[model samples]
Target: MDPHGYEHLTPAEAIAYQNQLRQKINICELTTPIKTIAGADISFDKNSDILYAGIVVFRYPDMQVITTATAISHTSFPYISGLLAFREVPALFNAWNNLYSKPDILVLDGQGIAHERRMGIATHFGLLTGVPTIGSAKSRLYGKYIEPADKLFAESPMYDNNELVGIALRSKPRCKPIYISPGHNINMQQSVDVIKNCIRGYRIPEPTRQAHLLVNKIRIENGDNRTKQMGLFD
Candidate 1:
């Protein structure tokens, strides 16, 4: 599906689009070995129309940063709780186009199937790009579960009604848990396993953590100036 034109969609239209997109989400085991993985994030100032998107690719297992891409774009979509993909993915798609080294897996700092419509930013991007993606959200948007043990890698199942949606993972001791869910072209178990492997003494996984840092750094470097631009760095 094309990843454009969403900025002009009304809330109702966006929700309907999400429902349509959710039908195409394919959650299954990854068929390819992961040699490279990426983390995606977006940053913007409060009440600002400008969005700074970042995608960081890393060498898998070793988790060394390899490629970084960034994009700046103005969004017209209002900040709706469940419709964030419409507001954010256009700029992220611009950044994705700037990426020189596409990874085997893409981890996003948002919901996946763990959403009200099961169409979070990660899943939306995955369907748009046809890439294996996972959502590693810092908080839960849907579902219920008992908190996991306060230890590294402790995880508990999260369910919506009777259906399994995601996992609540304690990635670090003392830190609040993060939510893990398959975005597209991947399954729940594989999502948790990939996130576990990406953790490196941090509350957030390496790929997404690095991506968060990168986007924030770019936003700071650019200061309050906002413009439409796309940049790639090795």
Candidate 2:
């Protein structure tokens, strides 16, 4: 099944496709003032083909949740190491189409430009929607870095093949740092700063933390008995 013509491709073809899209990534300073930001995440229904995609939009500095969106779909793509965007992003696009208002930037619970392929879920989603996006993951997908200081707002540059690609951000003191990278139309430093402002005494930031809760809420309401995973990036 072709869910936008690329999902059905063979593994080799998918890698090539990722390499092609990688060229389209634009890493530059954000010119637009960020008033609203949306945190995007996806979860799978236990032992089933159903997947849920969620988006939570909130005021930037105020951090007030304004609206939320969710989409359910049967994903035809399988989970792979480098081709994660293909498995997850179609459902996200379904949710994106239902959003009340487009966010100025999207903070996603997955890799951005910092993937082995350089085209992770965050970057793919940003290109598809033409919005600035950032990827904040609980784990590192690629890039090398030393651990940042165990304090709030500490970060270290993450490099892949000797090229700086992202940041390892310590959002809260004594907590494991979250990996952050630019998805589209934003620089690495800007991505780190945006996530830092969204933290609210948790390892995960508010936008994504709220989004994680909302998606789990939707999954639980749908009769899934799985326990909620506790991480901002999950």
Candidate 3:
């Protein structure tokens, strides 16, 4: 599927697509002792002509890095808001395929139920892969919440039309919060707990932080100098 063509999907078509996709996601085929978790994110070249993705897998409790994969593809879609999954999925899944240790859960840098039809990249990928997944993004795509001032687990529930969508979690003191949402096979609180369990030093969790670094590293190694492109916060 051409990411550029996603824009052609009408509002009704988008909703239908989402409904069709929901049929494939069970959201119950999940393991509690998720021994492995993976993180995925994408980056574009400064020229915005190339897309790069990184996937990092980590063992639970111990948090040992087990595997890493990186992939690059010609940018197939223009940078369009609300149509980001189309742009990133092609290359990102390639990276997912390259990994040796399949993770029990996947963390994406997009939303889960924060989109037009309560679907975003994380939800899309979760359904496509049938893996328990969640979205931990840095910004809000929709809904409203009272931003918490405290750090270290300060959070507020995010809502849209009174529907619980996600949570804004502050993992660090005085730092911006990360948006948390269930992608598949998880609940809202579990999403937050999983993210909290994965944190190490940085604002983002270790697996995701490493994945972000690796994507940027790949960009640099491939001569993709997009002003270092500034890593996506999450």
TM-scores of all candidate predictions against the true structure: 0.94, 0.92, 0.87
**1-234: candidate 1 lDDT, tens digit per residue:** 456788768899889889888899999889899999999999998758899999999998889989899999998888889988998999999999999868999999999999988898899999999999999999989999999999888989989899898999999999999999999999999999989999999899999999999999998898754333322221
Error of 1 at 181 (Å): 0.3
Which candidate's TM-score is highest? 1
lDDT tens digits, residue span 1-234, model 2 = 234665677889888877877888999999999999999888877666788889999988889988999998887778888788888888888888899899999998888988887887899888878899999999998999999998888889889878988899998888889999999999988898899889899999887888889888898889765445434346
Q: 1 or 2: which has the higher lDDT?
A: 1
Prediction 2 TM-score vs. true: 0.92
Ranked by TM-score from best down, the candidates are: 1, 2, 3
Best by lDDT: 1
RMSD to native, candidate 2: 5.0
Considering summed lDDT, which 10 consecutive residues are worst modelled in model 3? 225-234
Model 1 segments beyond 4 Å from truth? 225-234
